[model samples]
Target chain A: MENFHIDGSTYIPRIDFNAETGVLEIEGESYHEYTTEFFGPIFSWLEDYLEESGKEITMNFKMSYFNTSSSRRFLEILTLLEEYQNNKEGQVVVNWYYEENDVDMLESGEEYADDVELTFNLLPY
Target chain B: MGYMEHFSVKTFKQQLAMKKISLAFQGIFSQDVLALIGKSLRNTPESRVIAKRLFAIVIEMAQNIHHYSAEKQYSEKDGRDIGVGIVAIAEDDHHYIITSGNCIVKTEVPPLIERANYINGLSPEKLKEFYREQRKAPQREGKPGANLGFIDMVRKSGNPIEINIKEYDETRSFFILSVRVNKELQN
Candidate 1:
């Protein structure tokens, strides 16, 4: 598997998905014109990665902000992860990192945790 | 650039900032103006970055205007609602200022003001924590539609959030928010 790296733009976040470590990390802003267009491949990769047996996946998200369109897409990602965790043999962990003072971000993560079946660890960095 | 003009829809003058910028924009916050500024930010790297952050901020504010404003009409783009507003972007030596202005009713201002008051006072670390908690919590009224985007913008930009409110007319007034993104902090 190959790694994917996208430079973070002011309206977009930096995305790095490593096949070697099975760690997908995304950070920065994401409010693109076509929100779904940008995330299509990302969702696919996650789905494909889960096919590998005994593969440990660690998804880290340290974003400052995103838009409504992007927000819906984010929920889709979380949902996918939740299912992956349920069916996969290896352990999967979601590390949601936020600023210490930003209640909105922390709470956003918490909301996702409440909705999804997976257990997410909300961490402040 | 030297004087203020009044019209239903107008755009702001393009500016290049080196060090510092304030949190107020002096032009109409119409979609045309936002598009105009997006074009201007294309030339420089930092401004382009700042411009994107500014765009997200405006989207949220405009949505609030569309949803909460009493006097509003659907734009020509089918049913996309629009509200009267203004946005400004300025820069100097150290920081960048992104200001947005829109009219809101007296009743609507308090809750928004309270939220702004709560958000502006948090440190970067706390803001992140708050965001995480909010993300993991159940959907609150008027939250699922807007808060997600707002939180995303705050998390991606390496700056302090600022907000201010003032009255303009009966049952309607102006709400402006100025976000300052420091140059020295992030890349």
Candidate 2:
């Protein structure tokens, strides 16, 4: 019903969840002190959005890096998206963007894709 | 000087000389200081890609202390707790050695050592598989992570993770872990 946008910080990523567009984007590095505290609402927002809206969802991740805690959180987000994709009529697509030269980041995207059921578009820019 | 102190100092100096210490810090580990260190690393030699790798390892190591260190002191500004630890980065021509140490309960040492060894033993493909499995695994209660941080460290280092433990007292020990990232990765 509502949009969510939080600017990136030294330790956290930028999050933009647009209700109107049904497009959610998270970019930049995330190594926040309170990982769950920061991501709890974002998870809930996605849950509510999936239940409330009849629109397709597109999730984009463009992270240069993220710490271990944030890594788990991203996995959780992907798992949720996979769940929605499986049961819901509205489609869910994920795009993971990494630097072309970053082998680790590219592998990270592949790893995330491997865990979830949804087909992830691994984009290098 | 006591045997332990003398040995530690000597070994530390040897490491410094061998690796050409780029940055070193001891005592409190705080987010602000970590940010400053991360900022300074951006201008380092070779490539930004390798810089990011080194930075990721440093952050994981520092944050491990912040979350798990047995010794902690509260901050003045927000009264938020901060951990006591040591972290250093040293680079030779071929690799960057990032080391971090913190106090931990003596009982925790065995499993920590075992975990590090287990990760070191995994091949690259196995390590990636292990990492994926751990990501989906439920979080361990009380621990900040599901032991995923160590796996990530091993995966990024592209080398065997090294760990050393020194008994501090009857109840505590210092756990030191190091990860080596290839400088050639910069190319």
Number of the top-ranking candidate, with DockQ as the measure:
2
Give the clash count for model 2: 0
Separate DockQ for every predicted complex: 0.16, 0.62
lDDT of 2 by residue, A14-59 (tens): 9999999888999998888668888989988888888853468899
Best candidate (score: TM-score): 2
Error of 2 at A68 (Å): 1.5
Kindly list the per-residue Cα lDDT of model 1 for residues A10-125, writing each as its tens digit: 66689999989988899986655445568888877777777777778788889876666567667777777777777766667888998775555786688677777765899987
Query: Model 2, B1-187: lDDT tens per residue?
Result: 7769646887887887776897888866677777888898898787887888888888888888888899998977536888889899987668889999899998888988888889889998899888888777898887665467788877777888898988787889989898989987732
Tens-place lDDT digits, model 1, residues B1-187: 4344563222332222222333333323344544445446545455444545555666665545544555566667534555556555666576656666777777877876677667767777787667656655554554324355445546555554566778788877777766665654353
lDDT of each: 0.64, 0.84
Q: In order, what is each prediction's RMSD in angstroms?
A: 8.3, 4.1
